[model samples]
Target: MSEKPVRLAVCVVTYQEPFAHSAVCKSLAGLPQELLAHLSVVSVCNAAHGTIADDPVIEEHQAGALSYREVLRSDNRGLAGGYNAGLQIALDEAPDAALFLNADGWVEAWYLTWLLDGLRRQPDREAFVPTLISGARCVSPFRKRGIALNFYIIGWLCLRDGPFLRQLRFPDEFWLDGIDYWLSVKMAEAGLRIERTERCIAHNLSVSDQFGTLPGWRYRNILVSERRFLRWQKRPFREILVVHVRALARCLRYRRFDLAQVVAKEFAVALHE
Candidate 1:
């Protein structure tokens, strides 16, 4: 009998950048047809303009490899709510695995292959992470000392094809990517094994980015999210400092004193809030 094509779902959460999201969907269409068969997309869009149907890449592919679906939202939950909406669709569809990708990331076939491999081998407990590359450096490829340091757009893989669970454990509250710090926690609760893959995916870290640019809305979101971030991801004072150390230095380098001010003021000793 012929091997069954993987029923994969790529769920993207995006805001105001249509082209960036298009690049992501393009990557999906660009995947070799061997892997693209039976793949579907769930675009949980937060902006009024990011209509997935109009993406040129999708037009070019004609949903060739990817069937598209959307969840248009106007909520402030940001990553949390967006992901919740996507996962809901995934749950209903009962796909083998769903990749929760950020809209701005550019993915490659090898990473998707890796995700499928894990899902095929152990769909119930397997959650794969692709090597995250930024500016030529491999960032957060593996679990560092038991904690993930800024997991890049390889993002979360929610599994359902296996025998363990029926649905994904969704994030409760996060603004933009304040959710990154909370992802592993939810995976742990869901009994998923976090696996690091050797394949690399380049994340521009430019579009739909917060920590890099901290645009007006993102900056304000940061201010709104700081207390909870400090509360939940509380670690040692030194570790917390180390996390923001680069952010602080960036403030001095690019003259982003505003972000620096927030970092210095908001990122103090971690305590129960």
Candidate 2:
């Protein structure tokens, strides 16, 4: 008898760009056929008032192998909402694990195997984040902290457990920013373990260039989310104050007065809430 291949769902959320859709689909095509056989991709395209033709790259990939679903949203629902929509689909489908990948990100052939292997080692773990490599540099991995927030610095290819992530919902109030941070923190608070994998997943996007001219409302949403997380974690008032002070300094340094004011207003709202 043959061993059953692990069932996996690859969730990719998209907005506006057809090229991103193509890139993601192409990357999936690069995976081995045997592994692809056990995978199902769920793509949520948040076009939100526009219609786009089926991505040719996706079509081409599907022709060769793998099963997928493309969800087209009539209106622009932000990242958290889009992801939540995908999560719901995954739950309905009932895969062994759901892998969330950005539409613009490309994965190596062994990406699923590597991530799944790590996940299998820790039966208690609910979520796993890959070692992110943007260009040539490795992004910072999650550090474990004691009551004093002690950080553990591990090897470049080390995997560490942090928090659990299951049936976790992103706060609807925030449109963007701080979603990832808040999710991680909340998972920790829920006592669910999150692990960082040893393999590096390449991210081609540039962080600085992406948020160049984001509007004030979006920044306000971020501040609101951060405050919500702080409250959820039951952080000390002194610690919260310190975090805000640092945030204010960064805002001033960047001359983001609009964001600064929005954050200030959000602080008042947070206090009352």
Candidate 3:
């Protein structure tokens, strides 16, 4: 006559970082036994040309309290593909929620517990996310300045409810960039709520050093993704222009002339289309 606990699937998509994945598994394994009993760990290995097959820690922890599953792929399908592959398997189990965990990061056990409680408190919400930590920085760009949107999220512990999965899926065109932004927009368009937790926080390996040296291909992808997203949203040319103009100014301020030029060209294309 007791109420059943909600089932959760923690889907982690990893490429070649076995050590990071192991650390993540270790962190999950350390969760409270009662909490672990209601969750499953799904690790998607997206290694293209590596001999490594399985993660022992994930397998070993499977027997104890938490259930674990791994989806092995021989080709690199990028982030969306990898996550979708694992998501399909997780979806088959019909869990109450699925948390997309970054392989390069780990979450505090208490944070996840808090997130689950928040989800229960807000049943109307389609998704819940924990505040993120990387070194000394908080992932919320506007949090420190007291300006935060209701739907600002970045793929860490993105706990999507059953209704969310029934309505939306990750786009196929998305490879490595813009999927998260696209999803946030899609959810907002659908009038679905995505709440951010206050006490819960996930830690990620900081990549602040690479921001300044991002390659041209990445910039090009950003431009294309922004255009595609705006067009999909049916945004007006003037609105797109305002967005690009601000982006152009930011690029120029950062001395990224190459990206500034790309943004200018994209703005023209958006104007015409």
Candidate 4:
């Protein structure tokens, strides 16, 4: 009789950057063949200009590969929607665990091992997030003490057997920002523990050339997302306004009027309405 394989799934969402896609493929290629044997990866390409049906880099990786699935989206569904789409496919595979990896990020050889060990050891933990490092330094907000980070950039490693999975579903309403925060909050609300591993995963923080550089819209979306999170958390409007005002004051005091002006304007409007 053959032993049952320990099933695992990796989910990734991608845009139009071929280089980022290549980087992700390279990172996956670095994993051990034995580990790869029990794993499946689902990649979703969310490009507005039509999906990439095939890429030479991914084809090279898939050449003789034992475990993987690639899904190309015909239309761009934004980040949150793309991830959810990938997650749904991953869950359908009925893997013991599912990990979300960014196409722009790279993982160390033992990254999956560490995550799996964490989940195995702590049977109660619903999800585990690895520490995000840029080159040799940890760049994640969780790196610092007392820092209230609102996002999980390294993506999430979720255990399938936990009640958290059944209790929580990603909100499709959020266009981008605050999705991770809302998920984490929902997991906590369900009494499922969320843990962070000390292992560092490398994340490439490069902006896409094709996306064109526009900081204004990005900042505006962030403010709108924060407001949505505050409302979801059931925070009073007055309290949310006060928090934004304080953030603006701090930014101004630090001589960051560029950021202060943005927060102040958004908060002023949100407060009034």
Candidate 5:
């Protein structure tokens, strides 16, 4: 008898570019046959405007070693919604793990192989994120507690509150990773063991705020998501103050007073639903 090779759902969420020419497809097209045998791609697309629906690449990928499935919708549901749609389908097959990738990005084949080995070594981990490399920086291996608490909110403030950030190319994912942050808080509350990984993925800032505009609508969603998390954690008044003060300062500094207002106006937006 032999041990079965690990099966992975290489899940991607996208709203732009043709499916065949996407970073995910280009990478998949280059993968070795044996590796491809152990993988399936779950593509959740929010753009039905000929992005994935009419592309021949999905059929092409299905015809080869890779098994492919996609959920297409015209309505925009943000990142986590798209991820859930694809991951749910992938999970039905009981894959060993699901690797989520930024759709506007690519990962090296060796890193994918390394990730599988790491997953095998630590089968109990609830998740494993490759070091996300974009430009000269990366987001990886932050302590679990650091993210689950007010740090993410604080970072969002500092980035927006910075006078020069508007002119710089800062990544706004600190707020965008709210889904993962809340999950970390739950794991922390449960006393679950936390783990980290070293492999890397390159998230090319193609369709997102590559130039750090820090749009007002983005802020509203970010703050509302954090507000929901804080309430769920039953955080005290002062801890909440630490975040609000910084946010208020950013509002004044940017003259984007609407951010402070819309966070409440759009409180109905669901981070998990």
Candidate 6:
């Protein structure tokens, strides 16, 4: 007898934008039936601008084969809260693997299959981060020797098993800014495997390009997030200092003094923490 297929669940947290929401739905709709048969989708709608859960685009594309659930909220609960809402529903189904996908990002048709295949090939790995396709020239400046850092996994696609996530506790207080780092750090500390590969791929909606004009709250989030991340990760003082220095330089080069201030403030907080 053949073995049962692994169950996969995807949680997409969306706020305001309907077009982007539909885009993700359409992308998922195009997945092969073999995968879709065991796939469940949860769309958390935190529509501060307007309603998107009822948008015809999402309704039409999120039908057939795959199981779908919608959690609609009137206020924007931020990234972590929105994802936690959808995750709660997905976890109830107890999927073999669950992915936290951003509403503005979409993976290729074969992304899920490739990731599952890789995990199957290497069963030890608990978490997988897909390569990001974006318009930004330099997404992260924190390079080790020459290789660039992988800071893009936070919002793109954080795919992992249910059991592992439950152990670490999914998306906590640091969810707003350093969520990706937090999860990666915890997984490493727990001796769980995390691998980054090109086979599984996703595309960002060029949102990082607008980092210069982000709201003040986002900068504040970054400050708070880094302090928490530094404490939890137990990174050396020199490494953290160098990273913030580079960050300040980058912000100034981009004429975003506001962001530079955020970097400085985070460094100051880190000193006390």
- Predicted model with the maximum lDDT: 3
Summing lDDT over every window of 10 consecutive residues in candidate 3, give the lowest-scoring window: 141-150
Error of 1 at 227 (Å): 4.9
**Against the correct fold, how does model 3 do in TM-score?**
0.73
Candidate 3: tens digits of C-alpha lDDT, residues 165-224:
755567766666667666666666677666766753645422243546767677667667
- Runs of candidate 3 with Cα error greater than 4 angstroms are 19-23, 51-67, 119-124, 132-149, 157-161, 200-210, 238-252, 255-273
| Cα lDDT of model 5 by residue, 1-273, tens digit | 977888877667677444555666676767888788777777866665654434322332363455577666665565656665665566667677666666556556776676677666765554444455566666433442224332111110101111221122212333254665654454445444334445555454321323236667666656666666666667654544555666766666666666656543543343222
What would the per-residue lDDT of candidate 4 be over residues 1-273, giving only the tens digit for each residue?
964556777877777543234566677777788767867787766662444544312321362443466666666666777767766767776777777776666666677777666655666676677777666766542321222443455364555554555334567667566666676555545655667777666664432221133365665666777778777767767667765776666565656567667787888778666
Residue 268 lDDT in candidate 1:
56
Task: State the C-alpha lDDT per candidate.
Answer: 0.59, 0.59, 0.65, 0.62, 0.53, 0.64
Model 2 sits at a Cα RMSD from the real structure of: 6.0
Better of 1 and 6 by lDDT: 6
Clashes of each: 0, 7, 0, 0, 0, 0
Of the two candidates 2 and 5, the one with more favorable TM-score, higher being better, is 2
Report how far off residue 65 is in candidate 4 (Å).
Answer: 3.9
TM-score for predicted model 4 compared with the true structure: 0.74
Clashing pairs in 6: none
Model 6 over residues 104-173: C-alpha lDDT tens digits? 6666766677666755676676776666655544332122332224344554454566566665454567
The window of 10 residues in a row where model 4 has the poorest summed lDDT is 205-214
* lDDT per residue (tens digit) for residues 1-273 in model 1: 975667777778777554234667777767797777757777776654544543222221254555577665544346777777666676677677777776656667777777677666764456666667677776554343435543433364444455433444445667565565555555566566667766666665542233556564455455445445654666455555555575578767777777777666555533323
- Which parts of model 2 have CA positions greater than 4 angstroms off? 18-23, 51-67, 118-126, 133-140, 143-169, 189-195, 202-215, 255-261, 264-273
Clashes of 5: 0
For each candidate, C-alpha RMSD in Å?
5.4, 6.0, 5.2, 5.5, 10.3, 5.2
